[model samples]
Target: MNIVRKLALSASMVALCCTAASAANLTVGFSQIGSESGWRAAETSVTKQEAEKRGVTLKFADAQQKQENQIKALRGFIAQGVDAILVAPVVATGWEEVLKEAKEAKIPVVLLDRGVDAPQDLYLTSVASDQVKEGRVAGEWLAKTVGSKDCRVVELQGTVGSTPAINRKKGFEEAIASSKNISIVRSQTGDFTRSKGKEVMEGFLKAENGGKNICAMYAHNDDMAVGAIQAIKDAGLKPGTDILVVSIDAVPDIFAAMMKGEANATVELTPNMAGPAFDALDAYLKSGKQPAKFIITESKLYTPADDPKGEYERRKGLGY
Candidate 1:
């Protein structure tokens, strides 16, 4: 071959090799539930950041809060033959079939921030906070703050059948079970939205003598707590003062509320689920090491006494 032709051929071969190497880098598909709240949005942002940090190509899909949409996304990910899949399921019970498909394709699936009711063999691992523990922490904080006072607590629950809603309710109930002085006088679903939470709290206030009878409020999440705080103010009552406010998911807005003394306490559900998930995936893929089926994240509690403003500042840029 001529020298010029050989040089051109070598350059083309190098370009092709580089392209193939880039393509061979780990590619993961992430099927996220829609940004239903600030926490969810933060999770999505953090997942993308984590993928970028690890040089993994991420194929993201938003399910818009629908199980059918999530199922469809999972199928598409399977068809794409991704190296792995991460899903923060919108609900738990309807994941068996899609998960089975992933399992059959030999793709390791990880559940992020939520879990499924499917067989453990279907997914590599689930990375999430202990929902019950989160609720229990909030309840325990409320109980300790009240300190034997007869407290009539109203609960603003999450979406009715969500695993977080159910487990958090159970944990709070368990925490306050021994405290006869602390009772949940009114418990209703808020659908995990601010508007619904405000609506539900308004009803609770009207039913309980215009918020005078309620001593405190326990929301399944901070978004609901923030909404209920507004409801308390509209009803001519102070939230942190008249009715001690406590909830889970320490999103930035809740920290702002705490800074304003509108919220008393919250349990943090960190949006760093993807960090742990990617770690596990890397370990498994690199060494064939099997991770535990359930990988529980930290459930940290935050009170107003904590640096609320600092917390808010720290989480503000996370797209919350």
Candidate 2:
């Protein structure tokens, strides 16, 4: 090879080696909340992909939707002395002690997709969407769609204490406060699972005069929405037509439902929360630059008019 070509090749090889070495030098621990829903599963898949793309050595732990399990996992990561820790908290409380341990260990903890009730100084930064805004979007759409019509809505809430559940419910309530016609007649927690969603929705359908009294169903996530759709069908009621369906988390299945005209609206909660989490970690580790206490993600509303078929195609391979 010519001398110039040899130099270029050597430089390329050096850059590649340096990149690999950099990634190898840092180890990150990810404590996921288990595959509680399609959205959560998609987040896990996307997180692993992001870590792989960055060449990061990712240590994973599935907490199975238990706060105690998550705490134990965090302790395990701390004992392992991983470079950093990423957590999708199952609940908002009871994290301060473990986080304090992480703080003492000097391992920066980054909360992904959810937040804890602990003090801000306990972690590095949180990367999540404005969950309340997501609810507001859903509520606003419902309000506008059924303007001046008395609408008795039923809500499928997420896990009781999780930040998304709390914030999303609060936001939806706030949005519909001005609309006297819209009221949440019955609300129940689905624990953010499809099976539980279906079970609770069945009860709601039975309670609300065989689902005739209900004007709409709003879920905290798409998985629950899909479950509710099945329940509505079992009651011999058309989902999107008989009872308007709106929810958060634009999972691919929800798009499929929308395509089938079984669901009405959904708000997008991007599952790639790890992308920004990694970005903040890289910046903080390299330059001691602190990312904002909260790294807010973007959310958008989706409906049948937005082309559900295309959306389903786009997200189907993302493990949703």
Candidate 3:
């Protein structure tokens, strides 16, 4: 071919390749449960940051702690034809229909920080800490702390139907069962909110003879524990002194609380689940490979002794 004709053909091919590359940009839709707690906020922030780094277009929907809202949002994402969907479910139930819709649409869904009880093949992957393990850790710590001493504990649970609340309660009860001296006197749902945590704690205080018999408090998350601390103080008892407090989700606020002697211990549930979730999504999208059923992440127990100052500084950096 002539030089000019060859050049023109090459230019056309390059334009077509560029169009394909631009079309390859992934669009992800994320349905957040809500920003009810520090841990939830951190998860949102981290997920947004991760999406930005990956050049992914994230269509975010805030479910506002309602299952109906989440279902609506997921359907909307499916209708929009998003490449993938990530959801931090408010609760584990009532997800089958919407997830089936997404599956029928051939859109992969990733569950972050929470789980849904459905067919194993329903979701692409789940990235979360072992919530049951976190609860067991908290219970083990409490059992060791109050060894051989009859201690009346109150549980500030998460959202009533949420996986963390259910699994955490079960694991905690199992761990403390061997130690008959430790008993949970009051257990109520806090809805994973600071205000709810405080409100429920107040009721526990009143139920336990004006908070006099309450020996310790076990909260589902740090935000609730922090709120419970305020209630304990309001009831004229020195928290972390008169009644020890332990909880899950070691967000920055929890670390600060620990340093300030407001909280006793917390289990770390890292908010970086987005990375692994997206990694699975990438693999699934690239080669049509099916991902694992559950992607269990690691967790750690945090106490005052574990880099107290460093933990405080890290949490402070999180803008909590």
Candidate 4:
């Protein structure tokens, strides 16, 4: 471990010791990647809710979007000798070494919402949505909407080289492969942040004839899509009518945008990933029955016609 990891581990050990129970009830430690987005915050909230609902002792650690923090948190959990560990990895690589440590400690580590590039045996299972299908759904929606009309697209990507970024891009490309009328004219990474999304979209508008050449915008997440919508309007162009904005993660803000006729569509990426993760952990702990290696949550495309107002109301209080 590095100096940062060592420092973080030492600090977290005190907190974990105070909070983590030593009794016989199931004890699980979770290392989250921080609340960088609405969806991430929702996931964290739901994870805590699920653990409470199931009467499990949950030790939560916020990694603040750093790999070193996650490593530190995992080591702290292992030292605590918690029954299990959960990790939402910050990145795909650089996890094998820490994961091996978890396995040697006999802790079944479950991954939430994201994936790691390490060997499968290091973790018990991963609970996430089918990210490629999410991109495909968004692409298909754009393709069907455009029909035979020529359309140029600009993509706002997630963290470059991340699994969702790679898979979602591949899936969208696959869906639009046969559509000669629709071409992605520009693409850039937005780092899956609202500010970065707006900044990138501003650049795209300036480069693509002030948003005239861009017929549609496909963002890897709804936060970026929401920010891009602002960029579209600031450029004196209607977002849904001029650019046909579409993205993933059906966050409440996106639905609110749809209700205002700003965003066209969004593919739902449920934040209740920990609901399934906890269920799998419960089963495994109680019966020694291993769950499937991959627990895929469902993804659905939501449009204005699907009662965007009602959807917004329903999701507004879910920590999004």
Best candidate according to TM-score = 1
Better of 1 and 2 by TM-score: 1
- The pairs that clash in candidate 2 are none
lDDT tens digits by residue: candidate 4, 156-246: 9999998889989988999999999999999999999899999999999999999999999999999899899999999999999988999
Ranking by TM-score: 1, 4, 2, 3
The weakest ten consecutive residues by lDDT in model 1 span 1-10
Q: Write the per-residue lDDT of candidate 2 for residues 1-320, one digit (tens) a residue.
A: 23235334534544564565664456788889989567778898899889878877677778788887788778877886878999999888899999999999999999997778999999999998998999999999999999999999999999999778998999999999999999999999998778889999999999999999999999998888889899999999999999999999898899999999999999999999999999999999989999999999888999999999999998998877
Q: Residue by residue across 1-320, what tens digits does model 1's lDDT show?
A: 23235334534544554464665467788888898777788999999899878877777777789888778878877886878999998877988988899999999999997777888889999998998899899888888899988999999989989878999999999999989999999999999989999999999999999999999999998888989999999999999999999999889999999999999999999999999999999999889999999999998999888999999999999988
Look at candidate 2 and tell me the lDDT of residue 39: 71
In angstroms, the error of model 4 at 299 is 2.4
Better of 3 and 4 by TM-score: 4
lDDT of 2 at 319: 72
- The segments of candidate 1 whose C-alpha lies over 4 angstroms from its true place after superposition are 1-25, 65-81, 91-101, 206-210
Q: What lDDT, from 0 to 1, does candidate 3 have?
A: 0.85
After superposition, candidate 3 runs with Cα above 4 Å error: 1-26, 33-38, 55-57, 63-83, 89-106, 116-118, 158-163, 188-214, 234-237, 286-289, 312-320
Go through the candidates in order and give each one's C-alpha lDDT.
Answer: 0.88, 0.89, 0.85, 0.89
Local distance difference test, candidate 2: 0.89
Best by lDDT: 2
Q: Which whole-number lDDT from 0 to 100 does residue 43 have in model 2?
A: 91
Each candidate structure's TM-score, on Cα atoms with residue i matched to residue i, is 0.82, 0.76, 0.72, 0.80
